[model samples]
Target: MTATTVRAVLFDTFGTVVDWRSGIASAFDTVAARHSSRLDSVHLADAWRRRYAPSMQRITSGDRPYTDLDTLHRENLTSVLAEFELPFETSEADVYDLVHAWHELAPWPDSVPGLHALKAQYTIGPLSNGHTALLLEMAKSAGLPWDLIIGSDLTQAYKPDPAAYLRPAAILGLAPAEVMLVAAHNDDLRAARDSGLATAFVARPLEHGSDQSIDLEAESDWDVVADDIVHLAELLHPRLAR
Candidate 1:
């Protein structure tokens, strides 16, 4: 699809627009500090994140009943805590606060400015596995500037499902070709493309952290490969402005 024909740009949250690993790790560090424990927050964060795909896969494969991101996070948190053998002295309120930490994640430095630029030309929104409330809170916290919030909650299905990509196009009152999926993950872009939507890849090589090796590069052909969101906006500005 030509840039001028696209009516909206849908983004994958998490490592795409927000730095979930760093944000969650920082929050975990605070919890560790409170407990006066020498917990390895970085390792804890990595372990927790490693659970993300498998948890979602369980839902997708019907191995486990469907659950939202918040529920999944809590379940994983319980497992992580158990594995770490950490004391369970924290109140339920504290646990809730920590779970909500995902809602307050910070955006990548280029996210805000680049989104603003793209928003000027086309509608911009998140197409994330995050629940609606979670995405809304994150948008507010990270200054995401989305024209709308679209999450897996709406379709009760996560990404890689064609429905997840197409649902947002329907919500935006546009054809699949009229929407573009901009993300850091190649799999996400492939899903969008398979659903008939245009795709843009914005690399975030450090998203998995310094020691992690996943998602180091794009694995498929995308409509565009950008260094970051700001550079993506620059690439799209001419075609979208028309």
Candidate 2:
């Protein structure tokens, strides 16, 4: 947890760095426009995200072989589409495009600036459940200045599982304690902390939506807490904040 001991700073991507809901909804709107149809984009975005954890649980539980997040998202989109019963017929290409939207998600306003600040001081990249290809595409699209990518595909594990946190630190040639995880989700931070990594909680109250009720604040006494990614950068590198 000591500042000097930390060597690399990893982040949780989806809700932490990018506004996934808004980005996904915008993508849906574009597709709906393509078909000359009306779709409840926001509702679909929320519904699709709701299935994320459960879809990963099966793989984490060893019920199924570990699958990359892109495939899982595509499969989940099928069910989400079925549940919504879209007014217009959707083709396989449309399904693929909708799933690809995750890669194009826009970062939060402070994400780029804050990440630039951190990258100047430490090795920085994403340690997310997203697979390498997806995370790489997202980083390129979002201009995330990551030094390297450590994804589930590379580790064959997902977050909350100790391996997900531990593997990345090892890959970076650092001990778990030397790698800090910065995330908006309290549970994600808790898991990182439990796996011997230092944790920083960055609040993203609107990650879900304006009415989002959960993860409004740090649920536990994490190593550091801040209002946003820029604030996290400020806390970690006080000299730069000035």
Candidate 3:
């Protein structure tokens, strides 16, 4: 994939740009404080995220219809709550607010600036499983300067799915090869590659808060691999150097 061939970059939002674990842990702590329980916030956050993949798979396999990620998040949160057995009871409002934390997540220090760099040369926005409303709120919350959002909401199918990759190319009026998927997860990059998009892998070592067992680095020599988003931009758009 030549750098010259790429006209747009679609990103995976959660671990790729935002620190979901840290934000979710902080939210859990805040909620725990509300209920006056000394919950281990990080563990709860991990437990909640542990449900993410299987939750999506349920919908992807046609057993459940395509549901937006925000609803999936709420359902996962409710189920994780039962699994964790929160030490104290919380109201429905509290649970909704807890699920809403995804919308309030903080970006990695480089995310916005790196995007600013890339946006100079390419159409850029999320190609994540996150709902459009959720990604929009996150962009507003974190000042992400997106050209436009393209996600599972657009195709009603999550990434790793061919449609999720191809539909964005169609929407942008570009060939799949003309778009690049910038993500921290190798699996995501692999899917993008299979769908004919260029792939750039960026490391997000703390995405799972020190216990991250996977995606610690690029598994394949994708079109590009960089230490982080900023480096990715510099690598792809070397003119940014000046």
TM of each candidate vs. truth: 0.93, 0.98, 0.97
Span of ten consecutive residues with least summed lDDT in model 1 = 233-242
Give the per-residue lDDT digits (tens) of candidate 2, residues 1-242: 77788999999999999999999999899889999987889999999999999999898898989999999999999899889888899988888889999988999999999999888899999989999999999999999999999889999998788999999999988999999999999999989998999999999999988999999999999999988888888898897693
lDDT of each: 0.85, 0.92, 0.89
Error of 1 at 135 (Å): 0.7
Which candidate has the highest TM-score of all? 2
Candidate 1 residue runs with Cα over 4 Å from true position: 239-242
Q: Model 1 Cα displacement at 202 (Å)?
A: 0.5
Ranking by TM-score: 2, 3, 1
Model 3: how far is 190 from its true place, Å?
0.8
Tens digit of per-residue lDDT, candidate 1, span 1-242? 56788889989999999998899888887787777865677788888888988889987777876689999999898888778876546668757877999999999999998898898988999989998999999989999899988778887788787888887888778999999999999888888998999999998999987765766777887888889998888788765321
For model 3, how big is the CA root-mean-square deviation? 1.1
Error of 3 at 234 (Å): 0.7
Best by lDDT: 2
Cα lDDT tens digits for candidate 3, 7-123: 998898988999999999999889888878778899988999989999988877889989988888888988888887778887987888899999999999999889999999989
Q: Provide the lDDT at 119 for model 3.
A: 91
